[model samples]
Target: MGIEYKRRYALLLAARDSEYVKKVYGGYFNVFVAAYGDEEEEERWDMYRVVDGEFPDMDDLQSYDGFIVSGSPYDAYGDDNWILELCFLLQALDSMQKKVLGICFGHQVLCRALGGKVGKSDSGWDIGPRKVNIVNSCSLFETLFETLPALTIIECHQDEVLELPIGAEVIGFSDKTGVEMFRIGNHILGVQGHPEYSKDILNNLIDRLLSQDSIEIDQANEARSKLEIQEPNSKCWQEICKAFLKGLWNEYPSIEQ
Candidate 1:
């Protein structure tokens, strides 16, 4: 038999591993792998910390089957050098029609790179579990979500996509944000919530933000309170993300082109 190549994926990490995450989970890479990777598969996953100026070699981009962009504390609209470089990389990936998944800041930056508009949310910060209503008209909705009407996910962001790129479809939304999830053809997906985040992670982040005076005591308390009452539909989200990234939906028709 001929040699078989292992499937590979790239994580374009846009944020550093926080002290808490480093101590608890080894790093954000481990956390992401836990959420999206299949322990059974013999796949290879590489991480590129774009925030720290590390990036994958352009020549090796084609070897990766899919790419994921992680959330970041930085504003996606800022003209920072790394942000600009990330935009260029994303554009190249788009041209290659590689599968790419963006989360929060990743979602916003993906929009910005693909000729869409992104900016601060007029609704202020959304730092708790929120319901994101599925758009029934999206072609993949029936196949992926079936009769599910909405998804509850943990969210932490102040920036949002103001306009979508041409050919992009809004697949999910919520009362607080207009574009909660979107897709471009079969290759690109963007989510504005933290489907990969756990309650403890959010709690720690809240504490850090409070210490930095980023959010008031009452706001943090309210976020914490909401967490106690309802939990995120993490299992459902994991399926959705894995399916999109791993081409599990190849049997279905393309949602957009």
Candidate 2:
């Protein structure tokens, strides 16, 4: 389905507009998916080989200008062999100062890889377009819409970042979930919300999760209700994308323009 590809491509296009860089997908997805999303090769990527649960080679990671760790359906604290391997890979990538961006489960992986703790949250599930309060200034928040009410983003996750990775800056947060977002370094960022999700994409995702039994039946419907599904806030996304892009390039200005 184009649902998954559309969300992924949103991030890809954002990176494309912000200067120029070659991208590589470092998650687990089939190669055929690359041709399914878009026609522009440079405007898209096929990044599934990074964690194929087989023999993941990091050689491709080195050639890319930056990397994105896409969201996954698995829980980070679960008893899975691939989770540990992915954590190790993230840690190694961090050492190289790779400009890494992790979404949802990927964010949890960054936390675990860098000595942060992640497990089942007492809050159960954080779903819908909840408010993520800003705590401190970071690259992800530059030129962001902080003045316009709360940043209600599409968030879906059971495991939250309970601990901050070594020297990680606490950025935006939500009252519902304390650690909604954070940053480990100048180049590494983790977002708990789905800024990449359009309203339709998010609604469809809820349906898929319910059908596949990945999430509880009751919770999926409730999550959909909270999505806010209103105006298309491409500006909010610009704040996030530009911040991440500048952070990746280490181009933090004295004042956010």
State every prediction's TM-score relative to the real structure: 0.95, 0.70
The worst-scoring run of ten residues by lDDT in candidate 1 lies at 248-257
Model 1, residue 15: distance off in Å is 0.5
lDDT score of model 1? 0.90
- lDDT tens digits, residues 1-257, model 1? 95454689989999999999999999999999999888878788899999998999999999999999999999999999999999999999999999999999999999999999999889789999999998878765567655565789999998999999999999899999999999998899999998899999999999999999999999899999999998788877877888898887544332220
Computed on alpha carbons, the lDDT of every model, listed in order, comes to 0.90, 0.60
Candidate with top lDDT is 1
Q: Give residue 10's lDDT in candidate 2 (0 to 100).
A: 18
Clashes of 2: 2
lDDT of 2 by residue, 1-257 (tens): 44332223212111111111122232123211231233442334434433346423677556444456666667766557767777777787788886667777777778888989888889787766776676645544453433434566777777888888788987778887777778876677787876665565566667766777778978876776565554434346435544464342244333232
Each prediction's RMSD over C-alphas, in Å, is 3.4, 8.7
lDDT at 193 for candidate 1? 96
